[model samples]
Target: MPRARLHDVAEWTADGHRYRAELSAYLPRPALATGGPVLGTDVDLPSSWWADLREALAATAAVATTRTTVRQQWIDRHFTRLLGIPAPAIAWTTGHGDLHFANLTGPPLVICDWEGWGRIPVGFDAGLLHAYSLLRAGTAARIRRELAHVLDTPTGRAGELVALAQLLQVTARGGHPDLAPHLARHAERLTAMPVP
Candidate 1:
């Protein structure tokens, strides 16, 4: 897998609006051919695609993150507001903070957008991916099957909780209305804490 390496950063003001620009090396792969700009549309992915993603997640989990990057606290707030108080000492792992389809490229399986990478809830990345796939039940089921080991664990459930809670938060702000109910249902089911 290859990432677009940042080579330069510059900030300037134009038309009274502050703007920052980043110059990065280009990768050959285009973004995934999914329908939405941020989330993946329904697609029939081969088993190998999920396997490649699993491999990448496994490799990424080993990476260490700085204090500035751990995302658990924000996740906790979301989880607690929805689920009951979260389990104590939930585990964390390093992975792309945004694992939606738009940030990933396929056939060869390349995850992109590194600036958003950081330590996240252990199963959060996979759960986020699965959450995005909720529009299509088959794709969501495949994610569950491929990531069952992670999403089924106590820590993984916390990860899924974060994903669900965050998604619900987004829906509350007028995003993904179609997905709002699905997110709430899953949150209730996974957290066993009843979503209001």
Candidate 2:
């Protein structure tokens, strides 16, 4: 998988302000989406792209990381209220944490934006991509189909709900209003109960 390589980082105090800059290798391929993280329309991608994505995520999950993206306490505190169900025990794995369309590229799959990469619920990345694709039926279906191995298990379902709960919390803050209804509907399907 291709990715922008971080080369160096510098931080310094200039006058009364602090500044930081990072130098990274430029990636030539454009991201799969722009303007926002969610995909509003169906995108046409070849089967190979899907295969590559699956492989990439699998490889990422196999890595070990001490950084945490979704903590158990957060899930315990918010999951019941946000999901209308008790939080389940989650298995953890390394993931891209922010695996939406805007952070990925094609032709040859390249995952960008590594700042958020860390330990997360086992299916967090796949669930997040699936949630972002909810507005586009074709894309959503394709995600579910292509990532069924990870998205259709007990821990995976818990991870998906955790992902949806995170997005729903974001919606509460007036971000991605377009995704709220779809997310709520999907949450209902997952929990078999209306979200609070």
Candidate 3:
């Protein structure tokens, strides 16, 4: 898959602030058609677009990643809030690691930002995508429907539990405050586990 080509990277500090920058070739396409930034958007993607994404994900599955973006102990620790007994046993596979709307483009369906790409629990990519769609109920539902094969299993649900736990951890560190309650509610629904 053709992507924005990286040319150079440099880091420097100025007075009291530190900065890092990288230059990469630009894509002719706009960023994801989904609104912008971290905002939720109800993007109405076509079936063809979904098919392309599935194909791309299948390709992603073929590659192996040494990077373990999140350690098991950290995941299990936070997962206690959701599953109450750590993440359930689940399959594992290569994934984009960050499969949210911001990393995905529409029309041509080009995925960007590969730095976080790595091995994750099976269904983790779909689970992370669904997690990001929570604010937009319709988009979230569409993701579930499109990836039911992955999101509708015990193992798949475990993968989602981990993903939600990670999101909640991010929320704790000050992010997406509006998403906290929703994430908690969904976590309870998934595991019926008591939150501490």
Which regions of candidate 1 deviate over 4 angstroms?
Answer: 2-22, 25-29, 33-40, 67-70, 84-88
Report the lDDT of model 3 for residue 191.
74
Write one digit per residue (lDDT tens) for candidate 3, span 118-156: 878877888888877788899889999999988898778
* RMSD after Cα superposition, model 3: 3.4
Residue range 50-143, candidate 2, lDDT tens digits = 8988888888888887989888898999999898888988999999899988998887788888877889998888999999989999999999
lDDT of 3 at 127: 83
What local lDDT does model 2 show for residue 122? 84
Collision pairs in model 1: none
- Measured against the true structure, the TM-scores of the candidates, in listed sequence, are 0.82, 0.92, 0.83
- Candidate 2 total steric clashes: 0
Q: What TM-score number comes out for model 1? A: 0.82
Q: How big is the RMSD of model 2?
A: 2.4
> For model 1, how big is the CA root-mean-square deviation?
3.3
Per-model tally of clashing residue pairs: 0, 0, 0
